[model samples]
Target chain A: MITIEFIPFSQMSGLSTEQKIKKILKSVKSDKIVLLQGKLKKDEETELIKLTMSMVNEKFHGIEPAIFSPEIKNTGNFLKFLKEKFINMLLSDRQGITLVGPANLIKEIKRDPEKMQLLLDLNVSRRKKK
Target chain B: MLDKIRSALKSLFSGFFKKKKQLKLGLYGPPNGGKTTLANKICKDWLGEEMGSVSNIPHETREIKIKEQILIKSGNKQLTFNLVDTPGIATRIDYEDFVKAGLDEEEAKTRAKEATKGVIDSIKWLDSVDAVVVVLDATKDPLNQVNITILGNLQAKKIPVLIVGNKIDLKRADIKKIENTFPQYKVVGISAKYGTSVEDFYTELFNLVKP
Candidate 1:
């Protein structure tokens, strides 16, 4: 069976960077795909990848993370650009969605400006046979 | 306040008097993307030496390797920089995969451990690089998360980037697809192994590190 867990930004608002990563890793290790409400900071993403690498074992391979956000185009309008920047600062977490899942389960995650496609390897029985 | 003024003046004078520092050019991409091959080619072309060994297996480069003082000249123009060859970045590393590639169990586990450390090191080195050449396999799909994450991070840092579509000797190689996928950045196609179009790559390098 597969499970998906949604974690809102508020749930991680007060946690330290390490703590947030641990919380996400705990869920991924349990074979649950986490649907985070917003994107992680760039450094946070790097730290998460580093931490995930340390936890890889036979049963737990790693995590595949992807972020989907609206594209910020260059309209060449100064006022509009400033307005967008102001909005981004005000609601950073609400700007995008992040998906993180166990690498063994999620085969690939492809994204473009329009949409994201997640491919899964559902051959559990074959995997068990191996 | 006095210290701040002193530091400001120091920087002002250094900018005018200091010799130009060598640019650090980083080679980054997914595993088995011919990064080492290109590194070897570049090193051999100029220094008559190879940067590191290449293998058919993934994660062959489990540490960052640097080849310093590589100089390339084109007519009256010349550029010199330190070449940084980083391990292939991957979201997953399983020892079983290594075993399947004909490694013993113990060796596979050890390789997996080293590969993880390599990934961490690659991420940390991003802060130190002045420019980057993002090498990609021309035969593979270019829309994967690893490529996106690498490019996004470079964009966020405002680092100058030149994407290389490598392995174009193969029949399935499609450099045009990579070009369309990343229209914002400059893309060059070259077969690092056969030395095809490598001259163009060197020409692009001159523009990549333009001051």
Candidate 2:
């Protein structure tokens, strides 16, 4: 059977985004498939990549990260919108779901925009296990 | 002699890197955004089958669902891919919210727990996908947190993305606003529940996955 480790972002509320990302990186190092419940903040997501790239070495494989979130809802009157926009200009409040895994373990990531599906290349993974 | 051997090896190995056999297409959006409905429509149209069940409740698809090997044709163009219908992604999953949606306390909590895990699973599956279709309700505002997060993440990963403005059959559907919000992407409006402009969706989709 296939195994995937689920990591809900909510559960890590006590930790800073950076700390959570560190945990994800550690999980990927172990070849554990990690699913993040909430999406990473823009800066946090960027930092995660920077850290991953800097940390990758002969002992560690690179990570593959993907995120999904719900649709954005536009609401309220002009003044309320302006207030939110002004605040948003200074603070990044974007959030969603994110997942990370070992790049070497996952051979290929194929996406079909029309059908909205994500297919994996399992052959390479099986081959590597041997 | 070395240069000749290197050129020979390059040519011989080139065939091994031929076009991919199948693509992974992921359906993503907020809860109750008609992702499953769209998944069903695609399956019905090509595979002559239904992918999954749908309901009025939110997060109806609490687990990641897959329908493999769908080959869609448009004129001489042929596209083959696997369909991945992910659980609705939410910033928050409150058990009380599920209770309000009509589940009992225990069941609501259970569902909320499962839905929460489902969200994680969907996000995790992202690294395994090649492209994504962001399904949005055409009648709703397109500037919410979840939508922004999805877009930002895809941009970071450099993954090809297409936006689906679903539920156009509804009177309040505003495809233009969605288009304006994400001027960078190809946003196609359709009603997955009623099959409106789905052909155009397919066309746009074909263009989206092109290498």
Candidate 3:
């Protein structure tokens, strides 16, 4: 089982997103298995997507939502895409959870229907990691 | 083809029985946001009827409800409100029944898993309605995702919206904060449980919609 805990920048206050995620993965018992995807080097997106798909195929459903940064480009968008990919793989496959950002942030995004619509398409909320 | 003919016949006859234009207006908000309560108050005081059902549970309204509605005009020139109530958006809906609901599900779920599928569906519905009555719960944290989404999408689509901030009877209800957060909306606070401010709400609604 995996849990994607969104570290809302506001909640995390001073820490950078990568720092918070790195700290989380570092503190957690899971090994190199837990991913850190926001604002990574450009070379990382493909690897992150592949890693996430592999994890889900292994049935590593998330227990909570993963945190992301809006400042982090497609970090949140990518997670949403990952959900579509996972469901495409499972086809009524067991539920999986992947998070985009914190609730408050999601609320902010909600103000922009176009972006929020994208997030819904991405399945960032209900998909396993919040 | 045969079904539509039967439907038109049914409506033609029922129209005589009901004798109302049945203006379709939507009462939309996030889950547990007192949309049903507001709908109930309108049903009782103005419509002179009982509410369909009111519950604290989310997703209680998964489909639309039509009424033998009425339009009461004020002393002004001409205005009326024949209302329709639709399901609240945040409530987890099983669109699998879309076919029964008169739509094809496979085509709809094509957008499934997209974060804003919920928002997209909502935008589409908002367009169908003449005007919108946005409900907010004054008793809870005024800022919520569903309201943000509902209001934002409404604004994006330029749908006429009236913000209903309900449950003012509760001690914790803050009318001003809700007003402040959603300044873009024409906000009103109502104690739907007691029927306070409901008349004015319908009165305002009467002025906005078509007969």
TM-score of each: 0.89, 0.64, 0.50
DockQ comparisons of all candidates to the true complex: 0.58, 0.04, 0.04
Q: Tens digit of lDDT per residue, candidate 1, span A90-111?
A: 8886788889999999988877
* Candidate 2 local lDDT, B34-87, one digit each (tens): 999999999999999999999888888999998999999998898889999999
Give each prediction's root-mean-square deviation over alpha carbons: 3.5, 15.7, 16.3
Score candidate 3 by lDDT.
0.52
Scanning candidate 1 chain A in windows of ten residues, the lowest lDDT window is A121-130
DockQ of 2: 0.04
lDDT of 3 by residue, B20-85 (tens): 444567777765567767777766755678656775544455455655454454566444454556
The digit string of per-residue lDDT tens for model 3 on A1-130 reads 3244443324433565455444543423242223233333221222222222222211232112232223212456888777766654553212222233322112232222123221222343245456
Note the Cα lDDT for every prediction shown: 0.90, 0.77, 0.52
Q: Model 1, stretches more than 4 Å misplaced? A: A72-90, A125-130, B1-13, B16-20
Q: B149-171, model 1: which lDDT tens digit per residue?
A: 88878888988999999999999
